[model samples]
Target: MPSIAGTYKHYKNENFDEYFSAVGVPYMGRKMMGLSSPQMDITVDGDQMTIKTSSLMRKVEYTFKLGEEYEEHMPDTVLKCVTKIQNDNEIITESVIPATGEKCGRHYLFTDDECVITLTHDKAKVPAKRYFKRVTS
Candidate 1:
C-alpha cells in the first residue's frame, strides 16, 4: 500500500460544480472554489492524522484519530465526521451535515503518482472526483 502522508496539489475535478450545488453552496461560492487551486498536506503522527488544505479562498485544517468521530466546523457549516483507512489502500471520510441532516462521504485513494478524491452526497445524482498530483519534491 502507498503511504498516505504526502503533499498534493489539486489539478482537475469532475462534476465539481454540481457536487457543490448539491451540497447547498451558492453559485458565486462554487465559482470561486472552482477557480482556486488547492494544495493538501497530510501527515500522520501516531494514531492521529492531520490534513491541511490551502487555497486562494482560505486554509483549513482537520485533525482526527482513525475510526473516531469528531466535529468539524467548516466555513459555511458543521459536520459530524469520522475518518478511517480501508485495507491501508484508501482513506475514507464519512460525514453528516448538521443543517441538512444529510450523509456524505469522501474517499481518498493514494498512489505513487497521484491521489484521487471521490466526493459523494446523499442528494447528488453521481459522485464527484478531484485529482491531485503528489509533490515528490
Candidate 2:
C-alpha cells in the first residue's frame, strides 16, 4: 500500500447526507455533518498505523496494526474492527455492530494528491464517498 502519511482536508462529498439519513441520523444533524469539512491526518509506522480526524465539532483518533482488531469510536458509534491494507494503495476497515448485527466498512484509496473515502453500511442503499485533497504547507 501507498504511504498515506499526510494531512488531507475534506473537499467534497457524494451521497453523504443521504447515507446519514439512511443510517438513522436526524435531519438537522445530517445537514450539519454534510456542511462541515474535516481534516484527517494519517501516519504509517512500519506495521502500525494511526489516523486522526478533526472537524469543527469533534476530533477522533484511532490506531491499529494491519490485520488486527481494535476498538474504534466513530462519530456516532463505537465498534471493534479490523483494518487491512489492499490493492497497493487502499486501506479497508470493517466493523460489525453486535447489538444490531449491522456490518459497515470504509475504504480509503489514495493517489498522489487526493484520498477518496467510501463509507458502506449493510443497511444503507449505497455507499457514500468523501473526497479529500492533500494539504501542502
- Assess every candidate by TM-score: 0.94, 0.93
TM-score of 1: 0.94
Best of the candidates, TM-score: 1
**Candidate 1 residue-wise lDDT, 1-137, digit = tens:** 68889999999999999989987889999899988989999998888999899998899999999999998887778899999988776999999998789999899999888999999999998899999999952
Candidate lDDT scores, in order, read 0.90, 0.88
Listed per model in order, the count of residue pairs whose N, CA or C atoms clash below 3 Å is: 0, 0
Model 2 segments more than 4 A misplaced:
none
lDDT of 1 at 113: 81
Q: Which 10 residues in a row give candidate 1 its minimum summed lDDT?
A: 128-137
- What lDDT would candidate 1 get against the real structure? 0.90
Candidate 2: tens digits of C-alpha lDDT, residues 70-129: 988755777879998887689999998767889999999998888999999987898999
